[model samples]
Target chain A: MFDTERVKLLAERVRPTAPSRTRLLPVLAPLASLLPDGGLRRGTSVRCGAGPHGGALSLALALAAGPSAAGSWCAVVGMDDVGPLAAAGFGLDLDRLAVVRSGPAHWALATGVLIDGVDLVVVAPPPHPRPAAVRTLAARARDRGAVLVVVGPWSADHELVVERSSWHGLAEGAGRLQARRVTVVARGRGAAVRPVRRELWLPTATGKVAAA
Target chain B: MTALPRLLLVECPALTVPAVEPGAGGDEGGRRLRLFARVVDALAEVCPWIDPVRPGVCTLPIKGPTRYFGSEGAVLARVAEVVTTVMAAGPALAGEGTAVGAGDGAPPVPPVPPVPPVRLGVADGLFAATLAARAGTVVAVGETERFLAPWPVDVLGDPDLADVLVRLGLTTLGRFAALPAPDVLARFGAAGARCHRVARGLDGELPGWRVPGTSRHLLAALGRDLALTEHQPGFWGGASAADERAAEVLTDLQRRLGPEAVVVPVLEGGRGPADRCRLVPWRPAGTSAEDDRGLHGRAQARGGRASEPPWPGRLPPPAPARVAAGGTGERAGAAEVADGDGAPVAVTARGLLTGRPARLSVGGGPWMPVTGWSAPWPVEERWWSRGRRRAARLQVLAGGSEGRAYLLVVERGRWRVEAAYD
Candidate 1:
């Protein structure tokens, strides 16, 4: 294992940089494909679809489970539907979750404050947020090395977009509503230079989310 | 060698307020505490050993400070004068030149409110010092016995213990303290014993009553590690300063917004998404971290559980991130339930399910028909309780071209999407 290439890579890793902006955070194994780096890239933003109550919220919980379970603090701001029972079921370590349900006017400000200490921040963007304000929060998240997950009605500068989500468990009737299979499309002008598409089960029948 | 330490208790009114309405007494007490803190911080040049007991109540051990000021009474007068000056000059000190008839173009400075009553009590023990302050009097050194004798036993502040003492005809502190310590303990219990101790002015010489964080005598009380004792009083000052500042900022934020505005979500055991977690006010530095450890050990104990068998019907892991406990909120989870493209779904008795649901097409895309599905998992919870619940969890694959899936639940005889697999 003592090779010149390994040494060179190790040297590059140790090279000095702005500390917080470079910290890497974990994402659930199933949600890896949704990110450009196959993991939650600190200081970047990702947009996911808002589902029919359980849709986006469940996926967001699954995405946050990896980092939160690994002891990284996650904050869900302006999101109320995701109750503690659902959050706990998603394998999210509840001890580390800070749900900032502050009003609409204070969501962005609360997100900014939270990003400084937490590893991941999932927030529902206000109905109409000015581009400048969104950019400021993204920049701040990047500066603080936190992953910013925007849920619901957002179309702007994001590193990736996980959309076109469809529920998988229920049929017309006479059956149990169980899993969900969603389409993950990568679209952004940043690291994801080329668009990539992948299909996934946000959660399988066993109550676990995994990539297909 | 001399014995007990002299303690001063500063008793300020409006320390605690009753909750009458919005922005009521409790919050104003906090504001008053900050004003008191500001006054104390300004006087840090003289009084260094100040310890806050509660909002507007603090203990100032004046033994060393009195040495510099010449006498105990002199020290008291100095503090009173400082309080008067600060109250009078507060607005003038607040910048912006906003004063009446100011040359600068701005609104006039408001008239300063009259200073609140402050009682200064000097005694040998905390209980006695507090009592002395509340009475707005000072007990001369070693005359604490006579001063305490005439007061009612109710001054102990334990109403239950005082009640029994009154019934037993031990009407005054002197009569109460006259009883043998062993007899009081056998008769009245722990609180009564504590009352007996407070009555006797023996607190200053008591083993635990020494001035905290001081000279060799105090260090000896801590079982002083002689080698590490000297010159390290402020060892953790720099680190603690930043931590304290962070705590202060969070405390200020909690005050500005309603306590619920900032919350820390803690997971508790429960059967459904609604019962599993609750919000507690957030503190950047709180006992919550340690509290979570205890919660982790007792993670199985659902919040507010009474005497009932634990319900085994719990939502499986990979809990939904957002569970709309109530069907309606800022973000509605599953308000309307239908089967197979806007068609209502019905769950028949004996665990059978049948219904037609609506189709969902986002962005004007073609409707994805939910084609195939599995059996219904019906759950009836808390049958023993008055508000029992019944729901059937279902799973189905929706997309025709692509095999997409979603999780739905039929509760209260209606079907709504609970989660999705994608």
Candidate 2:
């Protein structure tokens, strides 16, 4: 006969885990030092708006390097308007990148596929983001161990406004280096609203981010 | 292998299921969801022999399907037949056209045996198939490399492979596939090998196929004078000897193979009730597709959306349904009823019969009678109007398997199973 008592005693009681702590992923601020964490944490989401010379794309490039540097893959989903030339200007290595132009209608499906295996997924939020849908995806990202970055202007009516753990506002361009600087607003648990200014720089000699 | 006519892979999406609408016509999230489900279902219906159903911007592998179907022409016919039947029900599905694996720079291969109406293009391989599908004409074998040449650098768009190819000054599919396998691998590793294989007319991996039993479709043609009862037995039982004037058509189906198929019942206002829009796959022991045709034919003749595809999976959890729930509340159960204290019972006997029923028993508290219920809560946008919103009316909080709170609401009496703690 099987030892039921011993088996029951040996079986560990499962416990529910609390929601993981949120971490701030840093983008290069034109006027400030690199972010404290060096990069965004896995499973975190952020929103950004572009300045005169495409500040949003610039910030994405800085984050892309973090994963590509580790030889991992990164994908951009649901971006239709961003031209290839503009993407290249931000010094993003196209070789390590996969851009999905799903247009506006199929953004959700594309987002679902991209977040499955990629280290980082950058998406432009739906025209009208459903808080419920976003939350579902956020939870999925957490489960899959992937980072999600929402790029575009903030919507007042969006159900979930993935609050900024650290936010950087790009400033107007001033020079060839002008494409880099931005003012960041930071706030969240264990975070403060530091009105810090930072400068952006491209370390690659030819001013182009080489293919990763 | 050289003597065998080059094989072409053609994929036709179900017309009845468009990409944009999950639940179209009258359903929420319409058409889009239905299309995806139908594609999966169609693949399931033709499985084991079809092998693996690959979802990509590329054509499926032809090895397993070709082998099982006995001939290349037979496989093409089977694919076309499924697509044609689906088209009869709704929107016309578009075929992906033909793709061939001709060695580089060869003449276009002609379609043999059963011919297709859609213009087809044969290419040296799958990559060229995708490119040829766009042009409406098939690219022949042997000419794949030469034909793929000069199509622009952006065509080889996979970043890892494309960038390497561009750097090597090899922009076209022909040039990329022409490179020595060893040199390409030495320079680009596994990705280069893949690019080379794709450039050639060969799949990097040989996938399996799972084609299910054939779906049998039944058709019924009847005289205008025929009564609904004459076909009731066939409709419900899926087969019957009805009036001599009526004819039935039957088509075979593989899975969920049974008679008593799910049928969409008409609710008030000549629309299909949510629960009634279901069809069982397999018929009963004695019934066949012939019986199904008789049953479905009568339903269509009576002015309704004819039954076509099989039933879908079970619905998500239900939402609360209150046609008229209203009032300012102050009492303990006042909010539940919503109509102040002692309002007339909104839970009418007829309402109880027409709506989904739920039983609630209060314990450990003073049991107060539900004196009255009122307020047309969350009246989902009036059904007559187009572009109505699907909003649930109730605010429910349930726990998941992990004991996490999940916020769910019923909009318009339809329950949408929402995410946990969401």
Candidate 3:
């Protein structure tokens, strides 16, 4: 004597008012168009890599900047020499940022612990990471509603690659470095199946992200 | 045997209360105890190991704070600054006449008491440090005996022993210390023997010097126990629910991976990206709430300013994303810069490049063409000191304009990759 219609109505009434909205973490305005939902989706893992010319670390820091500025606790693991000044330049709240310098041996363990509590974790995974560790980390992030941004190769839900980058304001025996423009390509498995490309300044003259 | 710990003793003359009779002076004594508690609380910001010796005095081991603040002189200056600010703000915080009669409607503002000066001194041990504080001088290392030589025996706080010593022609500590230890022990018993050792600067403490239950008295005055029972979440800007959660895992990770494995960034004034920011070990809140509050208060004060204090030679914004781990030559990768003729490039004494950098190699890596580079920026640090360094920096663009960028530094004819714009 199960009534399918009544059950369906009850399920709708108990569901979140806007499930997608609550699940999304804000991103910078210029980088929003590159994401499917215009923000980082919680519990999702994203992989970011740099081209031969570098911008991956900056881009990853920029992505985390959104949540960190929005009062989320962010931990950067395996990046021992991460420049906090550059992170601050990218709009991260330095007060809430913790840098965990875990060696390759404890990289997975550290990231897993951080994922259990932190809102966003940007980790540089060790080379040849164990598949089991990767699976457990992704599962933990999902279960804990944390965002994982990997700075290396991984089977991620979304992938962002710095397709190309160029530094501006320097010449042979001339001016100092001032800014960098980059092309970031975004692709994912679900709604973002189609690849997306965006051109922006990874860091402008004032050390903040802006549209190129 | 390990050397006696170097202690910094701070004495507030106005707050000292007689240990023999508790609350003898009634309201005035209680007020002094309350004010002393506030002083101790404020000094906790400088270092957490402050030991309240009695009502008006405290001592802290200076070694740890010296290392953190860079030098003993700096620590002394900081302690002086903190104590002065606290003393200046004491009366208003303690409330002028509120304690006299709480139920009285709008009690008249009582006359403000003059703030007493705080005495700061450092020496080898507690006894010597206390004397040093009274004299307002620092006893040089291995010089405590010399510093204590001229002090009268009466300062040891034993009237009967001091009277007997004076009658025996041992008026000064130096004279009394000259007596053989066995002779002194044989002549005067245990207490006199201990006092003789203190005079010689061997022992740092004496019986009855530290008043028991001082913390209990302080707690009674402050109306709360010294140890906090629970943490106040969101007590500061970053202390939100998310912060509490993050702190839990971070602390757990620290326990597992070791404390040094986890760090939080502290921005400071310096010329280079690495110098501008420092990574310090993360400490859980509440356990050291005063320390955190002090640091955050300083940061917030800086934030209230118009702009950061300018470093004349600091690289223009757009700071490098990845700075080398160590300072100067420690972790920087060796780099070779060559000109179009393949000759090694160098920076001259006048800070001009001897040759245009056309190629570069880092850490024995494959050589990349340096398509573009900036003029050298000269850096002369600590020039007046013996460890002075003269170096030059160059911004090099390798591969192409859109290729990799590096911050290259040359010191003593050697070059290294100081940072990357990755």
Candidate 4:
């Protein structure tokens, strides 16, 4: 008969787990060395709500391409036609990539399913009218165990606000004319890690991330 | 004897009305949320030619239906009948105050009157339909081309295509479709090809029809229909009753799907690298069976982002309902939500559910790993817009077969679950 211990082991086998110790994956860093936790968590959601063309999506694409390059299936959900060009520019493998064109629910459903099958999944969280959906999606990720990346420009005028306790400007490259390096610092997640800063580069080929 | 095709673009902002209500409480509530859905069904009832529904995106693939109806006029008549029937049953079907009367004053309470009159505009092709809907002018067949000829090219929403059309000095769809296909493709790319299709009345020619509107996947109800209540705290305070109801719904799903069932959330925002997904073990409130034990091993699925809550440091307050239940209905039957209008109150949790977990294939062999590992992948794009480009990023994947499976990102190495492949 199946008991709690056996059932627990079976469940653990199906649901993927996070690496015990944080390790930086090898990759060219534009902000700094890779995060100490390896990368984004598998089935939760994280957002880069900067602005239009504010590097939110670019960040998401960068994050998704890393695992996808390693032969794991990766999916770009909800983004219509906008994905292929971006993926190609980064020199990430598209063969392992699938773009699903669907409405919000379909997008959510697809993202939820792909979370298990692919190495990474990214979704675009549209600004308001349905913030509840975003919350539900967050819980879904928790239950299903998929890395959920939610990025979009934040707008308070629309009644949607991210209540932050403090704000430290993320340092981007310091050059005579343009920014060459970028770093993001958090002031309040319990423990504080120094802001990471690194010069950014887009490699010309896949399986290669040498300093530019 | 070649003839130009009539095209129509219908823009019903009212179609977005359904989004106003949160979850499907009942079938009546669902109907109230999307009255057009009833009209679609009524059309099918009256004509039997209307296609089955696909959620999201409005344009119905009506070419077959139009052909089957014998002409565009016949199709229009059928649509009108559907509209009329829905309006006629508005008060009786959707409930009080939902149906508008001729003069207003809220249309006289319960047993409400029929639906109010509606305005329509028809023209040839997508643009024409859009224009007609905007103008409240419905065109008769054969006159579509003439009606559409004088409109501006900006209506299509593609400036590049518009500029090219202007350079070519081509103004009308009828004229544009007359041009060679190769030239259009060469000069304008995909947009040009699309324009040609619209001009030829072949725009919505794709054979299948997608149902328009969102459907909820999770539904919840307590034993013996307890009084459903809402506890809206002062601004982001304790979890609303809705949140509680939803949690129960999630627990039920996890139990049924096994601990391998992953919960992926859509996290809010961040600056430096943050976790987008994570996994929550399938340990519900009271039960942990050995069958559940075996299930927990499969937790290696995507979770959600690891970004600090936008609330920052201040944790989200507790929710009202502790757990919810999944209604014993299939996806199709579940599509009819009944919550607000005397129907059962149920919350729909929408996400992808899979019957089998992900298996990594190596050299024709399928392998399932019990270890969760993640690496960071960086992305930066759009240097041209706003003079700001994306900083590099790191993506992480996690989860182990013995307990959990997940994908996470470590931009600079801070981690969070991105999704659970349950």
Candidate 5:
């Protein structure tokens, strides 16, 4: 027996006061199940490590692909030889992507500057990095609300390790390489303490990420 | 907008000093400036208000000259005669190179240096007038837009803007002018908006078109100041807040690290992964005008159809995640490829492997069993020069099913690891 006009008016009035969307940068649909939050939480750090068979760089590039295509600026630091065409194939918008090459001495300084203005920063830590520098960078990233993706070892909120990888479309001197299949084991702290495993095509036939 | 001033421009193509050599106190640069000053002084006799646009170019208000000389054509002829005479007299003063004093005990006649071409034109504004001078045509007052229609957008002297415009299919001024003003402002920022106005003939000037401190250089060469006040153009204030913030941080980083340390990727047409993209130093707009002008032609060539052709024999996708830093083959790591019998493998003349690759060692590392590999793809480049390269590529999967993938190349009986799929 309620008046329909009154109900509609009341709904509109309450809608404006509803909580805003969570401050999470989106990841590709296929990668959603691998993370506890289903998206990258800003102001946190993620570590990507390689296993006996290396696929760490590919995984990092794929993770950056999502936010980059969504109009966020991404920078790659300390990886002097990172291939740009491959980054482009992984769905990153090259126009917004920058590459900063720094020697071991200035690696942290360069990465620190990028994290200030850039939305997402992917850095490869130098060998035997100073503990103080690592702590300072993590704290800065948190304060600036920027996501830091470390390619090498670092204690972070989440850790994604490439457990195993295999290539498809190649044989004994026959066909060419077309795609890569990998197993990523993701683990994190706090609410994301449970470990999760994902089987994915890091780069499928069209150079894009998809579930296997 | 108010009507732009109609002006006449004269250009000496050969007399202009290269912008790269600023404050060029060198002998050649000084000589050219002095010659140009002479040309300006000669033109002053015909029209009192002559403006030196650059080292070799000058302009004047054409209205008064036209009325005094009875027509625009008459004024152009007079200016042309005066400029030609001065340019022809320039080389005789340098007596060092051409036929030095004929040691014949007779009066020596210094050879005349070839006369540099002097072009004249008239248009409604300085931008159009400069282009008109280059074409050696006099554009009617109301026809500035029509005259600018067919010229390419690169003439705006902004390579980055021109590259984007060409990619968007607005190659000519008329097409660019057809776009609504507000949209250009929103998409391309203030610099683009200014160029858009110039394209539409709504504005008469563009930033960085005139050389700074030209009058000072003239005074130093002639020992007299023309009292020309330097015109300071307004700074661009149209960038978004995010852009400005990013630019500020990047500039700070550039100051800390060298300029070459920070780079951005530019895609180009080529067969190899390393060749397909190059990293150029990031430059914020409005800071380097001369460099931008120099890069204009290269940017256009890259963004045009010249780079659009599909390169045959290009490796199929899922390009390697890591490439050698240098495009040249020297930077690649030396690798050893052997057969099951431990004999070194080689590529034959027909682009075939002498034996099936079984074990591989990269950078003298431990050997790993090869799991899968592709057939050799022959690559022959620059055959006409001494740098001719005859090489073959093979995609090799090493270790095991859960292992690494690499792009291996062989040349002159030597193998190297050029890239990796990670």
Candidate 6:
């Protein structure tokens, strides 16, 4: 009994804007268990830190391998420790990585601009931002379908955390240094509510990451 | 930055040195390039991507970013605003390493001098845009040929190629470009073919990548491979799988993510991480790094400079991951190096290790430390030049276990990490 034109107009007026859905990005086999859906989720930030020895850098590079291999450009901002050659050793395609070494002050804004086009954004954690600033950056990443990987001691309530890292290879004081294995613990944050736990070698003896 | 040319005379070229030396400083355009590049980056705040044509020239594709503005003229006004601000701010603010925010709502920034000479041009192709920019004229969208009709043929940069047309009494770009494509290709060869394409407002046809010295050979190969269909057997007129598929994917991807998204990076042959590679904008399919640079050998042949001499005492492989790239890439803070024992070692002016740190274990065996290290080799080139050259290069390679080595540089009384052996 309703007029067709009136009904169509009512439906259009009440339509809900769908949440942006980003395609899953590739993740290295070693750390696949760390992320939800066994892949690097878009619009999400996964946190990592330095291992007992020196595993933080090795782990960060491992996270980049998958997406860069998938033809997506990745940028590492403010992490002065890692360079193109070391990244190349970790199996990252240097051509796809644009390293922007900005100071602590400009990290958030520079990262926001990079996320617009870049698929993956890795930043060395700066001092915790005010809540409003964090929300703004998170919103930008979500809108652009970019995944932010925060390294170092980041203060934001991160969805994923790879903690209690330990390095193995060198005997008490004799043999050569070799691998990094860490326990990746995940927590529910924002609207996403789910937890995960897994163990993996951030880098094997061959200088590449794989299952522990 | 040109405002501080007197500062540059002090030999502190800093980050803008790369773009500044050859383009602006080389006496070619006598224009501000560092300012031009920064203006483009600043424009990216509103406009998505801009194709930089050289030191004095660049084009913003208004069709894309103009949607955010009320009209195309608004977008042009915003670009012109950035150009004037960057140009007026001078080169110091252009600091190429980090992009400082182009804040709209600012708590007082530097004063911007009035810029009246900055020009913007709109047209069908980049070449036309450049011409219009030079004349400070905006060509209508569809009337590129008409706009170009009255222009002289010498507008083409290549004089040898343009002279043939001048001799033929063809004064305008419209007259030369209107000739048969095949006849133009046959008469003037490859370089002329490019000029003809530009004249015809078909500037989009030129290869996107910067053509190095191997260009003559690469151009032929590109032409031959583009239309080939030998791989696909069934189709009468089809492209082969490897050749066309790569180009097709490259172009298709470029369309979606802007031109800067898809690039071919070429590493030039040289020492020093920063000096080793030059980034070329475009790459042909199946282009190997070995074949990437044919120009370097020719330049070397002409100059036979010592810059490329085998740096014997230079650092080993596994170069430092980050070179700051602006001002001085090496941070003044992270300049110290540690020995095997995790102790900081003092490097004497003679480039010798003053106090060797404790011998710690290296993966395979006990670390064997060197009793004496080599002297710091000093490199000072172009002592007479007022600017645009390295004043000194201090290199020393020492330390590490059996398989590991460290290369360090001492510049301006401060130490720096250059490269290291794996």
TM-score of chain A of each: 0.79, 0.61, 0.94, 0.59, 0.88, 0.78
Distance (Å) between predicted and true CA of B356, model 5?
A: 1.1
TM-score pick, better of 3 and 5 = 3
Off by over 4 Å in 5: A1-22, A190-192, B1-239, B289-307
Error of 6 at B233 (Å): 27
The number of clashing residue pairs in model 3 is 1
Best by DockQ: 3
Listed in order, each prediction's TM-score against the native is 0.50, 0.30, 0.62, 0.29, 0.59, 0.42
Order of candidate numbers by TM-score, starting with the best: 3, 5, 1, 6, 2, 4
The C-alpha lDDT values of all candidates are 0.58, 0.37, 0.81, 0.38, 0.78, 0.51
- How are the candidates ranked when ordered by lDDT, highest leading? 3, 5, 1, 6, 4, 2
Residue A85, candidate 6: how far off, in angstroms? 2.3
Model 1 CA deviation exceeding 4 Å by range: A1-22, A28-41, A49-59, A83-91, A153-158, A163-181, A188-192, B1-257, B264-270, B277-318, B327-344, B349-351, B354-379, B389-422
Q: Model 3: DockQ against the native?
A: 0.40
DockQ of each: 0.21, 0.01, 0.40, 0.02, 0.28, 0.12
User: Could you give candidate 6's per-residue lDDT for residues B1-422 as a string of tens digits?
Assistant: 00100000000111111222322232311233444445556765764334343334445556645556877677767777776677667544323433222343322322223224366667665556656665666665577778877788988777776687989988788789789999989999887887887787665323432221111122122233322332222253432332233333333334323344334323434445545433333333333444334334334432543455575433333343343332135442234434656675554545445444333223234444432233344434344886433322322222322122233454544445454222
Q: What is the docking quality class of candidate 6?
A: incorrect
Which of the CAPRI classes, incorrect, acceptable, medium or high, describes model 3? acceptable
User: How would you encode candidate 3's per-residue C-alpha lDDT over B1-422 as one tens digit per residue?
Assistant: 13566889999875665652334334555667888888888887887656678888988778778877999899999988888787777664334545532343334334345544588899987899999998889888889998998999999888999999999999999999999999999988998988998899887878788775565466546655321211222333324546546776786566445657888887767777777777777876654454464356436634843576887787788899888888565688899999989999999999999998888999988889998899998988788999988998889999865689999999999998888998
lDDT of 3 by residue, A72-126 (tens): 8899998887888889899998888899988887799899889867889999998
Residue A85 CA error for candidate 4 (Å)? 7.4
Candidate 3 lands at a TM-score of 0.62
Judging by lDDT against the true structure, name the best candidate. Answer: 3
Two-chain DockQ for model 2:
0.01
Better of 2 and 6 by lDDT: 6
lDDT of 5 by residue, B112-141 (tens): 345345888899777999999888899997
**Candidate 3 Cα misplacement greater than 4 A, ranges:** A1-7, A190-192, B1-239, B289-307
TM-score of chain A for candidate 1? 0.79
Better of 2 and 4 by lDDT: 4
